[model samples]
Target: MAGPTTQEPVKTQQKCVAIFALLCCFAVLVVLIFSSVDIWGDNEDGITEENCSKNCRIVLVENIPDGLYLSMDGRRHLPLSVGFHELLDQAKHSVEVVSPVWDLNSWDVETMPSTAKQGQLLFQRLLSLKSHGVKLKIASSLNNSAELKTLAANSAEVHFVNMTALTKGGLHSSFWVVDRKHIYIGSADMDWRSLSKRKELGVMAYNCSCLALDLHRVFSFYWQLHERDYIPSIWSKRVTALYGKHAALELQLNATQATAYVSTSPDLFCPKDRTRDVDAIYQVIQSARTFIFISVTDYLPLVNRSFRGTTVTRYWSPIDEMIREAVVLKGVKVRLLISFWKKTHPLTFNFVTSLKSLCMQLHNCSLEVRFFSHREQKDDIQYGLNHNKYMVTDNTFYIGNHDWVGSEFAVNAGVGLVVRMTNSVKDKGMTILEHLKAVFERDWRSRYAKNL
Candidate 1:
């Protein structure tokens, strides 16, 4: 009897202990779940309507979880492909795109890797969005577009601005504006190479209406040149709307505030005396306090280079003069990352070598050049373009369409997005300069890069 009584009490105690433990675990789990969540949480993945209202200006790719993507260096990089479609998918009002070549065939020609498959799906979604009556306007040269025209007839419109007619050159700008508020300014074209195989870079301007609209002003200018009967009276209205003389605007990207100079070339639609894209590059390079990092699909300084297998001054450009001055006089460290894609000029190699030779002779300044070639696709049709046209100084960042080589670069109308960090602190404690330098250094050291 004594033993039975003792066992019953012991069982009760054990049950009570177990129940207490379960309760504590449940409470801890609840606390942990709530701890990770935020009622006013800011979305770092992409800008949503909710996030935009709260002034989420920039969406950093590499900072977020799983943002790392393996680039040419076999090192992980922040993916440019992550939020590209998320913005497009979230667009409710309009979609505007500007690229040198808006090749539509890329989506369906073949199955691509996951990133490019996403791009293909994005194109289809855009068409679907257009069919559903979302306003779609594309400012691209319709090269192979019996299909694009047909698709446009279903729900969208393609307005081609002939560069030869508009500026006696070509159009090489690649950007997108969604709903007149979010803008993507980068080096990727609307081609298959851009989406899948090419390593491209740009910033997504979210919840920044002023910058988007200013870039749209450039779009409006080119869109006016298309001569569409559907919108015949849009010229003067667009011109009046876009024309202005405001040099820079007070803009905020999340917490980083800066004065952004929205510069465009030719000064056709807006006020006269605007700094052309090339001129802006010159200014940035000249004003760099520490160093300058340049990444271009093609880099031809306006100097004497062997053009088409002949040594000539046809490439002599004032921009080249400025670059030389930066190295020869100011002692600025210059790192060049140029791409070797299909249709590249053979003279490009020799020209780069010449630059190296000149820099080798200099003791005051230093110049380094590297080439970026994809690891897998030299002999295959899967090769992509390294079409990145951008530069970053100590605190300033620029994304432009022009190649910066004066003669070969100025063949078309180009646009530049110039931004600087005015405040001492970076947005969310991550500097764009750091991000750029990390990426540049990785490419510079990657096995894909070649020294001149």
Candidate 2:
């Protein structure tokens, strides 16, 4: 070979420098786009078309067992699996999902039960997203998730958040933000039980880009924490919420005016302009003038933590106090429907008794507690539990991922959605608030509910 000229080496060096400069410019542009206050949504007095939309349609989705039938109401909500499939089909560009569990295949056993069919179908649909040229990104805290690993190998992007190392918690959030326009937030996880065996409730909002954008910010927050063990001191504005409790997005749901916002758990995860999960729950309870119906799998107001090597247990009374105040001081009728399962904590009953005692001698106070029990053919405590975590009042409805446990609010990573309708009563169609209230009433009046 002939010897290379010195000018050729200089030309290669110049090309390398040019590429480096281009990359630097790209990085600076990305930073500016994310950190700029004038970017993303409009900042014209905090209300703009970028973060607010009209004529949005929101539907309530539920998963009830075939045997578990409530009274025949002409109104039947869409099934949860159907809702997920619709979102999958509507996704054009990207689909971002955050769930703690990813066992949709249900162990992939050859002799899988009939209940696993729905989950299996959903899993296949998720895998098909890549073939359609849609970007699929998933965030979870599960370390040994085989499904996630397989998906990651097949053109899906997966990120793991170390909740245990950061806050001694787990990622319990379950939501989907599709194409930055549609969203689903609820108690159901990406599991087989949530699809068929367990009871799940969620809301699917279509053509609501404002609310979906806010939820996508939350997903971005988790996506940024993929390989980090500690939270950053300062976060980029891109992950911050565009609409929160005070500045909710005004939209028309089923032809009725309503305000909606998304909330996250464990104050530490809530960036600027984001509302905490507990505060969201409190707002719903406080705004209830007539009644407050709460249904959760667990309702213990105690926080258990390891402090400097020793275990400490203390009463975390924010929500507990809020319920008591709503019942006694605000004269709001409070009804709690807690699930009774093998994992029911002993302290839960004691707190229920204490809450019941507040209305014992008072005439205005109305606090009632009920335990919802379900029977299954197989003795699997983990499968048949009522996995609902929501609160429906007279005007507002709140759907969340965390149970009413103090530790869940204190440390776990979850999300909550609050939608308050202004003209819910006068709307021709049944509002989401009324639908959830009816569902609660059905569960409350069913034979499975037992009074405390």
Candidate 3:
């Protein structure tokens, strides 16, 4: 009996030892699997936001109308066409572009108009990129664009994002990422009007891989949703944002130290760590200490949605409320310059009037609204308009692709760049905030602007 009991205890001890050894093996296997797999989407060159160089050179690019000119300052800005060409010229490895439309070639016209020559040239240069052993990738929601078709046939990888199917809206994001080091973010699209006739404003950053990488993740997100009709339940880390409002990248832009970050719209489209467009705008407005200058094509505090085959509308008052608080409560001065074109919203005037009434009988409250009307001699419907979508405060500047519409923030896919600089950094050239503020003041005081 003693012998049997002693043997039983030893057998039990051996079983316990076996289980412990198996657990160790399992842990080792898990570590090896995760180590070999790319779960974090590390940079190809092993560059991270922490170790990457931050001395980024930034330039403000604008496209003024052929005839209309705003007399603000004598400084000449780099034209939009020249900026795009420079980006193409500097490309070595790859170029990724995201635009809502691809109507660069005016296929409807028999004789190519002079206005479209710049666009055609840009399209040709983009095509030549693939021939130079440089990869070209494009993301757009346009399905039947002849320009996109032609480019795709000639070594360009074009991916379609079904915006309507995904968000009941369209993609209005426009930007470019080159070689994972340079970027261009602005209000211009890949259309002829944007290149030649429309008044557009944007920024170009060179050697800003820290910021470029974050924007590239946005492009990668759209690229991965080419044929999918629904948002993915799980997202790859490759499409996740590297920096957001909570953790903006600190960089020396134009020899001035600043903090910058990128934000995206449509909450469903934002993956891990991406800031929402509405939230970004709120932060900018809330942080303003003195004055806020806003220029957008449209501003309406309403959202129209279609649900269950029925149309529904709601009052979206986040931005509107912020502006009122800034003026009435915080005593911050605010100026709004809205574009007045053929397609201007009828309800826009009503909203402007309401905003102006906030300061009717109050002290220390200043709010002004102006409509920028641009009329061309030829009466071209699409040209000769102020298409700027940006805002500049005392120390912050925001450049984005969406108009100040509630629907734009609720459903559309767009991107915004926020740059905050110290007021003490006074270099030879003007910083972005100063340049944009000057541009705003020039337009606000011009004859084209009319009081509400």
Candidate 2 Cα misplacement greater than 4 A, ranges: 1-52, 108-113, 378-383, 424-427
Which residue runs does candidate 3 get wrong by more than 4 Å? 1-45, 108-115, 376-381
lDDT of 1 at 288: 82
How far out, in Å, is residue 449 in model 3? Answer: 1.0
Give the clashing pairs for model 2: none
Model 2: ten consecutive residues of lowest lDDT:
38-47
Per-candidate alpha-carbon RMSD to the true structure = 24.6, 8.5, 4.7
Residues 54-97, candidate 2: write the lDDT tens digits: 66888899988666766747777899999999999899888999
TM-score (C-alpha) between model 1 and the true structure: 0.75
Name the 10 consecutive residues with the lowest summed lDDT in model 3. 35-44
Scored by lDDT, model 2 comes in at 0.86
How far is 358's C-alpha from truth in model 1 (Å)? 3.8
Cα lDDT computed for each candidate against the true fold: 0.64, 0.86, 0.87
Per lDDT, the best of the predicted structures is 3
User: How many clashes in each candidate?
Assistant: 4, 0, 0
